[model samples]
Target: MARVLFVVFGGLAYLIFFATFLYLIAFVGDLPGVPRTVDHGPAGDRITAFIVDLGLIGLFGLQHTIMARQGFKRGWTAIVPKPVERSVYVLFASIALLILFAFWRPIPQPVWAVENPLAVSVIWGLFALGWLIVLSSTFLINHFELFGLKQVYQNLRGAAPSPPRFRQPFFYRLVRHPLYAGFIIAFWATPEMTLGHLLFSVGMTIYILIAIPYEERDLVGALGDDYASYRGRVGMLFPRLRRASPSTPPLEARDS
Candidate 1:
């Protein structure tokens, strides 16, 4: 019963997010106080924007699907994590508030308009260009997950000690945390970037900070001294061109 409830609620929540995303695509430029003269373009540009939004939805769906495959229980358990139960409520509340604002907020039509068609085109073009880069990065990162290719080491949950297997090449060659990097890029390039979205960004950043440390702690436990050496070489979220050591094995030879 709990699993069933979770699936219903989670699906509804996903729909609400997609609905708001589409709403933003249609109305962002029309919002009151929004500068009209920023940029405008051909119908093709509008279609491109729709494609980007759909791609984002797909990317998020993929992430959730992967987690579900990893033994995610159904219903409320699907929506709510048993660990940190309070966080589930907060997450749902936040999503609900964002949805309400997306639909109910009275965004007045901008009095100051983009009178020039050329200028409007330019604004849209710039947004589209940035979005393209963001989407490309996200798609590349997700491809790795879809393939189920493991790298040198994996981070165990809850700061437990574990060593991820060593990897020599491929996508893992460039960055330690490609998924997080993709997320950061997407958030920055989102067309609906607003004060509320900035707040969401901060919230996500905090979660990353808190969650990563514990996850690292677990890796340390599993990998022991070897993970410590890798930690010294690889960065948390950034790709470094040069590091002191390239491929150091975790102290513990066995995979956790």
Candidate 2:
């Protein structure tokens, strides 16, 4: 019964996180339906809005970075069941994102607005491609595990989760972090760039840059030589001029 209840909790958490992720796409893209986007939102004092936006980004960075640390997980799991630890992390991260989305204030003053029809179309194409890469990269590893569903399912089945292994499938072969690369592309490729949008992109880019070292440190500690060797050969977020053999392993990224 406890195991079953955990599965229920995990399922709910997964649903919430998935919904938040989808909404995030819309929010970042400034799509039509979302109530508040990076560029479209309630007006406020520019200075105040800037501070608030900065704080929101900081909050997310803290939550994302701190919770993902191995030290945090080592202590955190003493209270949270091992099976649901990842799920709880996902839940908390989703909540942080939701809070950011809810309180975001847009400074819609134009930074750059592309007038050329062809350029605009190209930028939009890159935006879509970025999102596609992000989503597909999740599957290249284990999406269920990355999102926490697989751990809970294993718990329900009274089975142990698989150990981490090294990998660089397809997009990963080109870049060590295709997911982050995708986000960078999506954020910067917009045809209409506003102060708010620029801030969002810049903030996220800084966070990604800062986060990568710590994440890589963790990966190296956990994966040792295999990952180190892989890192040596591949670009952190871009394709190397040289190539590696087509063999990839299953090294989990936790969720970069």
Candidate 3:
């Protein structure tokens, strides 16, 4: 019964996360049919809207960073079952995103609007590509484990957790964080750049920048030499221009 419940939680969390992620694409793109978007939402005082928007972004960053820390996970797992810890994390993240979507106050002041047909098409193409990279990058690692399904399955079978192993399959070989790279692209690759949109992009990009060091530090502590070596060789979010030296080991890194 406990195992079944964990499975249910994990599955539901994954479903919600998937839906939230899709909604995020439309939300950021300001696509037609969405109730609200970064640049189209409830109207309010410019100052108040900016404050509210910044608060929302800060809330999101804090939740993501604090929760992802190893110290927090150790304490959090004490309350949330080990099998469902990752699932719960997924659920919380989805909820935070939904909250942002719901209450966001748009600062619709125009920053840049691309009227060029060809350039607009190109930017949109990059936007789509960014989301594709993010989605695909998950599978490059262990998508199930990254999202939490694997843990529940292991628990259901009464199997011990699998040992951690480093892998730099495909995109990981190109950049240390292809997932984050994709996000940066998606956030900025819009034909219309409003103040609200700029805020969202800059805020998220800053979070990613701040997050990489902490994430890398944790990865180094967990995976030790392999990650340190990989970090030494690969750029954080961009492809390294310099070729790897002959003495360098094959890239070996993984993200949770």
Candidate that would win on TM-score: 3
Candidate 3 local lDDT, 22-116, one digit each (tens): 99999999999989988788899889998999999998999899999999999999899999999999999999999999999999999999999
Model 3 TM-score (2 dp): 0.96
Clashing pairs in 2: 165-251, 166-249, 167-249
State TM-scores per candidate. 0.38, 0.94, 0.96
Estimate the overall C-alpha local distance difference test score of candidate 3. 0.92
Candidate 2 lands at a TM-score of 0.94
- Rank order (by lDDT, best first): 3, 2, 1
Off by over 4 Å in 1: 1-169, 190-193, 245-256
lDDT of each: 0.42, 0.91, 0.92
The alpha-carbon deviation from the true structure for residue 192 of candidate 1, after best TM-score superposition, in angstroms, is 7.3
lDDT tens per residue, model 1, 10-82:
4444455445444343333334533221122222333444453344333333333333332333345556544
Off by over 4 Å in 2: 243-256
Model 2, 24-143: lDDT tens digits are 889998999878899888899999999999999999999999999999999999999999999999999999999999999999899999999999999999999999999999999779
Clashing residue pairs in candidate 3 (N, C-alpha, C atoms within 3 angstroms) = none
Error of 3 at 93 (Å): 0.5
